[model samples]
Target chain A: MPDRVLRLQRIARATAVRAPARRPVMIAIAGDSAAGKTTLSGGLATLLGPGRVTTICVDDYHRYDREERRKLPFTALHPDCNYIGIMEQHLQLLATGEPILKPVYDHRTGQLARPELVCPGDFVIAEGLLPLHTKLARACFDIAVYLDPPEEIRRRWKIDRGVGKRGYDKHQVEAELQRREQESADFIRPQREYADVVVRFAPISEREDPPGTPLSAKLLLRPTIRHPDLSKVLAGDRRWTIHLKLDREENGRPVDALHIHGYAPREDSQEVEKAIWAQLGLEPGDPIHTLGHLANGERSEPLAITQLILLYHMLDESR
Target chain B: MPDRVLRLQRIARATAVRAPARRPVMIAIAGDSAAGKTTLSGGLATLLGPGRVTTICVDDYHRYDREERRKLPFTALHPDCNYIGIMEQHLQLLATGEPILKPVYDHRTGQLARPELVCPGDFVIAEGLLPLHTKLARACFDIAVYLDPPEEIRRRWKIDRGVGKRGYDKHQVEAELQRREQESADFIRPQREYADVVVRFAPISEREDPPGTPLSAKLLLRPTIRHPDLSKVLAGDRRWTIHLKLDREENGRPVDALHIHGYAPREDSQEVEKAIWAQLGLEPGDPIHTLGHLANGERSEPLAITQLILLYHMLDESR
Candidate 1:
């Protein structure tokens, strides 16, 4: 080959090598209109610390607010309607531990809210529609989760929350729910298959118990990509103790259910919570139970434990 | 219902709902594995006619093919793994009568191959992993689709296609499955959210075991707000005709389906036996099937028709 051709080949090779470094991870969170994924992710950020967590709401990427999804071709589920590729590309950047300026969509007013600067923290928690739903977004997360609430509970939550906070009446909330259902069917619900955990807040047994004070939480963990057995966690190591609880119980009356996780089967549970102790840097006799009293009667032990577990997972993933 | 808030809202609304002048319709086909989305879309496009058909593959948006996906976090299923948002923006421009330089990915090489300038044809079809996935993308299509092929068939199709075209043996294909499954579960399959149609190609009855063809294509048509009723196309409007057929039959069943549009489905299908006829303004007898026949015997009919539907939907939405 001519010298010029050789030079061009070298340049081409260099360019090819450089391209991968330039790309980053783009995580997206796609879910039903009011799935409360944000609430869960919020706790994650708190645990990881804001500096270590970069949160991107896929809703912000919406060209139109919740109102506009109704008139679109495929609802928000279709890639054509959303800047999916851009989000994907951004995610690639994040996965590579790079910084990005992500577009923000304001939920309060359905519009491009702001452009937030996102630097790769120890952990990047992207919560929105389709975050874990795409191949690109999935690659970025060390762990992925889905929040699936009972429809009735979700609706009731939406109604109460809407009236209380979002400034919408029951009728208006219902209308919004109908509109959102179209998009949810087309774009949100399918993301469940991609989650490592499917989290449901409603109580089991389908009882119509008035929404429990605080919230009752249930998480079905489907751990993928397991590494060499960390018997330490199963053995209840102190460090692992913060995030996990190990125990054996009767599951379906006959089957034995064993856990190496933070929550427990008993309502009384353990008086000493590892996750809480780990975060607060407290020992068994820490005086911070005063903070516990701050909870008044609004929170349940499971809820508190669940929060601690979420926090531990976030910090652990970051580390 | 505060009068001031209501009055402000009315004032903020656009004065006229202009029915946005009817433009070409654009349809996006998005799905996972062997979802029969492409096949169903082909039939619709064939009925529509070539003068209004244009096909653009969102698969082309992949930054890397199967091989390169291994080194990446999310593979093509991740939003960051694609140039999706840009693609959506381009589609939007095309729907409004513009052109774009689209990036191409070489499946055989597993690399970014080239970029080609694509003009907006009469009708546009954009299909791929994340098409109709994001808000920006969803805006570009008037119709959106998701193909949900059964896992067994999807795996088989992926295996055969990988072995046949992409140069992967069975073992390597299995390994690829292990690698790609994470991203696929996380991102690629979740795109079902944004689809107007969740299409599956398989037998509904396991016991009957239809001998003719195990794969009976099924589509869950989740029509958009303005999704056109196919009843219009069923009526004999010969202005444009799209043709769809079983392109490849396996075990007495159609393994591959094809679509030709903008003429008589029967006549047009015959004319383009080798090429997938897309783009606009074709003579009645033009060979539209060449696009599909260029590579393997694999019919590009599904791809072509998807483009046509997308084109129609895009134009229609633009109006």
Candidate 2:
């Protein structure tokens, strides 16, 4: 045999032998930029304990920093500029209980910061620009989530966040949103179709207490290879029931607000979210935020339950 | 005009105006695996002086570490597997005199170690895998270099180097090389075509006891850009010439082996190197073992002069 062939076989064998035995699980949380993705991820990480969970920002994959993105042909939303394949490959390696060198994009300086070596543990949460856009990266994740708050809600969230640090006033923030909307409109919205769960945090209705919904979080769970079943949570038993109302405003008309009930959410489904509210230690009378609308001080019992219940199912699935 | 559009235009103007006014010259050094590219870049950096010259390793863009690459479909050499576009964009930004947050790759742990903030300097030398591959990155550089040592020499060097840390003996090293060659054959070899200058180091042939080429070097200068004219260096009238036969191997092969002469290395480059060498100036000809490379050995005329001459050109062009 040629010496080279012999060497190849040996390296393959050595690599195989050295490879870690435990497989890492990948979880992707897709949301609009600054749509509480980090905050939510951080909360979950803290709850799960840092050692069991690893968090990765796809934002780190930005080709250029904030300042340079303006000069590029496409916005940061474009998949061509970020190393999507590399991110996918790294996720796979991490899922397999191996370590990877991750490229970091520094938000402060808006440059490729440095390579960060990430070792996967129990869960690898990959969040960033278009994690689900690429087929390979999407394949690596065991569970996927897309946060889909209403446009107004998301706009307010962005404005509030940007106003303090990004040096944008209310008007400037509003303008920046319009500018970014076109670039991300096609790309960001479509990811919802691929999400295992689409989370929307909005208000209950225009007529709720204080004449505005505080915070109602809604989720559209889609079945994927990793998560084939959602019946556990979708099965509407009071155990999983979130009491909330959803209203759609179209053509200057306020449509009827549908109230969600707690009994057997759907037939022929598993009770996945039993005791979810209790897990969050919430009660029927407890005041909480609604989803899809961001009116101030709107209170809803079911929407809050829905938010916590979905989270319950997700955490359980990942575990 | 829409209020948002107006604001975006204003932000764009402010950013464009705020961006660095005097962009620095970027130099890219490309080479095959273990082809002494790092050594050449380091030598130049040392000669140019650190404050004025910054060296960056694009190896940080690797999606996975050595171990993780085992399971990856494409190795780090593959464009898809690396964040090449991001790397290119960062290079472009640096060339424009902007500071970037670059990912850090740790060789010892084989992971993404950290994020480093790199500010552009007068001479930025970027070296690593596929430095010259992409057009965007290529367009950003003022100079490009490809190190083309004979494959046989590169293989030998890889073997010698891998044996110590990788726990590979001669046989294992040979096997690893064979395995790597297959993957690298497709991705690495072709990049050489893009180089503006091709450099190779070997012993002068048929010179019995002709000043032993000590750490000898030779460069084939092909100017790709209009700015840096090397007519002065090629003429070799006023520039320094090195006459070391260090390239001769044990079996009568040419492998640059000695350190000889340096004619009029730039004033700053000389001062920086002198400062570094002063610490190692235990004795005139004492060998300094650093990261497995030998330095400050027997004086050879040609090798030193060649390295210095290249440094002079690089520094002069940088200014």
Candidate 3:
């Protein structure tokens, strides 16, 4: 045989030997209600290609339905409101590339749906509150992220999502927010510290720019894992449109902060997007259109970029 | 002459024709008291080389002494408390590379000590509260940055600086912060919207890491100017440690966010620093040791990186 053919056969034999033992990469996206967790994960799913990615929402692990939850004094954010043991076991299964019958919670109807059979794909993205709240749950994932939109912005998003799609009226949504505020503070927000990355979507303060302007994002990139280097991409201009700085202090420790301008020229953003796509070892023109999109179908460049970064983590872990 | 030397001579001749008309690059660093404005400016001065840079403090424009100000209902943050007209004129002069006899404010004694000769250099960094508060002052700067440390963190920093350096007790410092709160809100903070960059130093929330842990920084880089491309630098790892994202919304517009991890390995930060230095066209291994050190002599990696980004702006403008 030719040397090249022999080399290829040797590599194929080695891959075949290792293929059965390789586990799928697991990612956890932990956040409060209406924190855009679904939007984020859906983008990643589209980017990774259907059938290659499996997504699970841990909200399905709730032991109580809406009516049942309403009867209790505790909010859905409480750990006791969830089937913590089952969720933990399923996560472990997914981490190990095992199949599981996963429960489903229909947010629109606030009811428990039929369990669905899920086989671990090349990638698994588990998003919802409390995913990173437990040690075992956290250990099951190769990467953990927390979506942390500002309260005011999040409240606005929740009100819109609740009233528009979830059958909640303005007054009802406000009351729910007020009721859940304590639980969110007590339980949900605390998960941020456990995350390797915290993504926040907030309005630019102090400016009177008109509405419909894309929202800005502040990413707190903790050093819990190895991150990509962006220095070369930013080497050309010294302007602040996109840049990196060390985080001041968080939980008494120093972290890194990454800022991206919503108004950055399309070309600049494209360069960044292409770079990130390349990091995934994917082609430059791969479909990223779904990455920064909003529920209304309007594209949010920031959201897309945020999802791309998370996708990088998942792909990196698989490598 | 040799062809290379002849080409250089021709270029030098072309440059001389444009030299007299070129204006010095002006950078404004505006922030409330103890916002680390001086430290930030000082770092830039060292990086750009002292002889090529001039540092100005607009706080010198205070029209009243400390005791005299005590009798008034207004705080120094109020425009009425300052020589707004003179500050405007001086800014214009400095922007045009002219000189002024600038007034001085002695924070230690709470007095106007002297009026000194001030000459603008190739690079001028004006740091103080309210530099971007007025349209004319804003117009004078090639780059404008507003330091926006969190109120809680700022209060703590003010108390420390006031007690340790300015000879004020805890109660006295607290009283000053309380007294100035309204004016700071009304005047100083509003200037942030006009800045090209808004820098905030904050501790990691939620967990209690340790006191000595490095702080994280969030820099809101507005799209007022063209910025550098950093996609290549971040293209490799896909890790969250150092990365950039498009901001969700700022003033109803999109912005870019850059995050750097303080806990990142030295090699990682060095890559960023080297990239920025290359953008500035500076030689590698140039002195940056003095960049991130604080007033107390302890170094903060975040502060240093922040200073470096600002330096890139200055050097870019000068080029």
Candidate 4:
């Protein structure tokens, strides 16, 4: 065997014995600000139940305050704006079930708050812009997800969140979005390639749906890991409520595309949730009502389903 | 009130004392030949249970047998080729819960079989190419549906069914499709505008899915009747699995477009189903597995959902 393969095998064996077998399963949810990382992670934490999951926001690793960030040439999306090395170390620690004094960033005042102690529980959800930016950081996760909402939707969400929660007006949010565009394109989107699953939320095109229609979701499931068999749900029947298609090849490798229709009937959404729950050997009545939505309490069926898929990976790894 | 309103009210009061204060609800499923009418109606019949629903194939109203049809200048889709007057009378009789001696056409041998006595059950499904071709016929239905599968997919299905079941080869089926094109366009397509629901099934575009990937469906719910309130399932949340959008207005009237994603997770489909069921005040455990698919045993989620929607109307009318 090649040296690299032998080394990887040894590491895998070690990891099987030490990490997943004895430690909490760690998931990395990487996305730009207001890209729904908190919502995704919080839902997973809820699904796993209270005290069973711990969440860490890597944006806390920002070395400069928001005001200081304004004076810097680079935006918060850049590696230099964050303590990337320390974030990598903490992620590795959390993956191995260790605790750390995690820093906190208060978006309300754009200041760094006092550090708080965090313990790894049965699961750890690390979410923020830079969680998967480094190879070492990527290696620390049992499962990794990237939230890739459309720029326009993300901007709208950011503006809404900024005004409502962080005391920023629409103009400031718009300016910030423009300022971060270059860094985001350079640093954020590339992380999606490293994720096991990439979720994009957007509206269906070419129609004037009434305002408040749910956003549709497109999930790109990479071949990095095995996903549950949805053949029974997705195959043989025409007129399915959820569509799974083989996406155009990426770098000559095929990927599966799962499109969860927005405004899908509750029964249809429940069917999908049950299929996924069955894969996890979970009971049917556990109430998955909390999985898909933002922190603002806006619900999304695709986000819920996407989070469930990631949870499946974590459970598989732990087992 | 207008004189017509007063007369109609009096007639309604008299009819209530005499007629369908207890009559079978009638549903019309109209489409071109090979448009999946049998599959759709059979599923609904199954859903409503065995002895409760009666199905009538209006193709039985053909004025001529297959050999005789071949001698005529018009195709089966043409009104001149069918017993339109008799069909209208039979539909009216069925709507009023009366029995009729309905004709039978043996699709296998292309011959007219002996007429059979059909009694109106608690529910009657009239499925064929021209059930909604006339205003009187349309009025006889409590609910009307038109299957509008894309031409290419319909063609493939036709060729497959022709070869496998009807004992026709590929070339013959192709020739028949060609022969029927003009009449189908002129007569069959027009019925869609008259339907309360129009269902179209096709593969998701821009991707090559595995052969068994379920076909997605688009349902145009015309505002001819009040549909179940899907507001909870479709509105508020931005990420739904079943999407209901405002269709481009038809004849300056707004309609709702319900798109059921094929290959949707079973959970998502169930959510949709449950929402509709809730609207109908139905218990969640009622089995709905039999609602979608063809007589050939092919299944479609959208078809099932579509049938469920129609069933809702029937149940509503019956109540």
TM-score (all chains, Cα) for each model: 0.41, 0.47, 0.47, 0.46
Among all candidates shown, the one with the greatest TM-score: 2
C-alpha root-mean-square deviation, each candidate: 23.7, 16.1, 31.0, 31.6
lDDT of 4 by residue, B1-319 (tens): 1332244345445544654433578888999878888877787788888688999999877767789887899888899887775677566556665565566777777776545557789898999989989766777777889999999888998998899887889999999999999999999999999999888888767567578877878888988877877777665442344688886765777889887777677577777777777777877775776666656576666677777778888887777
- CA shift at B154, candidate 4, in angstroms? 96
Q: After superposition, how far is residue A203 of candidate 3 from its true place, in Å?
A: 2.4
Candidate 4, residue B304: Cα displacement in angstroms equals 91
Sliding window of 10 residues with minimal summed lDDT for model 3 chain B: B1-10
User: How much is the lDDT of residue A176 in candidate 1?
Assistant: 68
Worst 10-residue lDDT window, candidate 4 chain B: B1-10
TM-score of chain A of each: 0.69, 0.72, 0.90, 0.88
Residue A110 in candidate 3, Cα distance off native in Å: 2.2
DockQ of candidate 4 compared with the true complex: 0.00
Writing each residue's lDDT as its tens digit, candidate 3 over B86-134 gives 6775676567555665667887788765355567889888888878877
Query: On residues A70-181, what C-alpha lDDT tens digit does candidate 1 reach at each position?
Result: 6665555555666664565566556655555455666666554334446666666678777765554565555566778888878987797788777888999898677668
lDDT of 4 by residue, A1-319 (tens): 1332344345445534654434677788999988878877888888887688888888888878888987899988899988775676566556655555566777777876545557788888889999999766777776789999988888988998989987889999899899889999999999998988888888767566577877778888888878877776665442345778887656777899888777677577767877888878887775577788667677777677777778888788767
Residues B57-165 of candidate 2 have per-residue lDDT tens digits of: 9987776767887787665677776777558656755776656667777876777655656777788899987888865666666678777777887887777677765
lDDT of each: 0.53, 0.58, 0.77, 0.77
Q: Please give, for residues A252-276, the per-residue lDDT of candidate 2 as tens digits.
A: 4322222343222332111222344
> On residues A29-144, what C-alpha lDDT tens digit does candidate 3 reach at each position?
99988898998898889878778998989988887888988789998889999877567767765675656656667787777654555778999889998998876677777788
